[model samples]
Target: MMEDTPSPIDRHITGLTGKARPRICYLATPSGDLPAHLDKFHAAYGDLGCETSHLAFFRQPDARSILVSDFRARLLEQDAIFVGGGNTKSALAVWREWGLDTVLKEAWGSGVLLAGMSAGAMCWFEAGLTDSFWGSAYRPLDCLGLLPGGCAVHYSSDSKRRETLHAAQQTRSIPSSIAIDDFAAVMYVGTSINTVVSWRTGSTAYQTYCKGGTVIETALSAKQISV
Candidate 1:
């Protein structure tokens, strides 16, 4: 777990209101660069009244554009910064120069709401088939430790990817882990996470990593299932 200082001005995600925190749109890919499978994210959140925007594939930071310019001010305008899922390696490569990852850490530390699907979520985890442009079919990358232990995005033991992740964990000797099922999202409030409304209209399975790992399929009902 990262030992970070308390954030300064917390971000106020636009739209919904509550001490319960604001809504964060987790796009399955970076803006303008989405995989064929997950393309409806833009309209999905926009229709729900979120001023959704894409930040991946951002050019050099400049106030006139989306990549740079005051990150703090831009963050203040939105309740949360939507993280677009894609190739973690590519994503990290794009921002590795500016240490954008560190910048994001600062934002998170300051209470900026961050929501992401697949890659977006996976990158934040401490480890687990990390940052692979070439489908990591059973191997791991030592990645940023946003969440505890290893985390598997798009988790499902039935699928090859899941099997690969499992194999990698054993092969690499990683620690306790959590895997999220497709069409499902795990929302975070500080260090805590609960199932938020999902997209797949399916079920997301949760798995344990430490001490004889186990997988649990968790189902949760919420006020808003789909917007």
Candidate 2:
């Protein structure tokens, strides 16, 4: 979620681009290209002196004006890509259909910093515990596989998330994973976690896996990035 003002996490992300004025592109596909969400993104990043832009799939005003090639070109030109949180299942389906998944992988390989929250964060991993099924219990959903292992978002706020993730690991439904609480994020360089950072005090991430026929949750040391 985006704050009313640029948060420390936001600054950290911008800094990762290693540009004085990074070209940041927001993808709101998970949220169905919600206008309000796009507004929030611009409001936050714009203030940070970022060259901000967003790609909207669901509500493209001039769909005819933007071709698939145009989308590809625009995305490749960005210094960073920020995905928004929403329905992971649906988002992946759309990305696959539009071949944006491949484009994203290429972008990452080219060193364009990829980041997001919740569903956005989950999309980068091999699989994730998702509530995208609506009425059904949280299930492990396959994701982009840009990063290895599984992911669990909203680990603290959503009580069922931790339970479902643990069960998935215990049953070998998904591999050893990381569970991230709100206001916290894990930074990965290649396939390994470089560090964990949190914008909220006491909010952190965890390494979850099944060991010796039991589920173990080990808290990852998080550096406070909050101002």
Candidate 3:
């Protein structure tokens, strides 16, 4: 349906999966496993010639007859896993309960493409700022640490996020890390960042770290992506 529109970002993700037709899973656990969140993922990537599935932890128990082990087995089949954005703290809590955290770590080691935005992105790093607790107040939390250091997504869109992350850096609460603007993503190969991509023309990425008791933010070049 969206064949007419070019998808540089999806293409980039697919490439990481190392498959011509990657089997992708949309995980909306961070969004409390919302149905609409999964629907949007299908709308975005369904026409991209990839096999797509959704993992609804909350609804699946009541909606289907399946074992958690069986679900874990299915996850191993995916070539790429795209986690959706929402409450990072809540999502991690549930993921730990179901052992998806270990499964994901295995997937990453086995070369499955792990990608997402905001909360999803933060989960891949050691730590990042999140507003999941206390409403809109951004606080630092230790995360999955798949990648080294921390991350701040929607960098330019949220003012508090920027301020809080900088403060974290200054106080050495978090290590040097990547901060990506809305519509921008940082691609990592293993633990190293490969490139920064943005869907919008003016979007950008930043490298933030503490230096001499001060926070240093260096602007990184961003490549524009289609669709």
Total backbone collisions for each predicted model: 10, 0, 0
Ten contiguous residues with the weakest lDDT in model 1 = 1-10
lDDT of 2 by residue, 70-107 (tens): 78888888999999999999999999999899999999
For each candidate, give its TM-score against the true structure.
0.68, 0.95, 0.91
Model 3, runs deviating above 4 Å: 1-8, 61-67
State which candidate, 1 or 2, has the greater TM-score. 2
Sorting all predicted structures by lDDT, with the top scorer first, yields 2, 3, 1
Ranking the candidates on TM-score from highest down gives 2, 3, 1
Off by over 4 Å in 2: 2-5, 62-69
Clashing pairs for model 1 are 7-110, 12-79, 13-79, 14-79, 28-85, 29-85, 61-68, 176-210, 177-209, 183-200
Taken over the whole model, the C-alpha lDDT of each candidate is 0.52, 0.88, 0.81
* 44 Cα displacement, candidate 2 (Å): 0.5
Q: Give the CA lDDT, 0 to 100, for residue 125 in model 3.
A: 93
Tens digits of per-residue lDDT, candidate 1, 1-227, equal 00032111112223323434344433333333543322354445444455545443433322223434444455545556656655666666655664667766776787766656556676777775653646446456555577777777666634775666656555556655666765555666666665454434465546554334543233445223432
Total clashes, candidate 1? Answer: 10
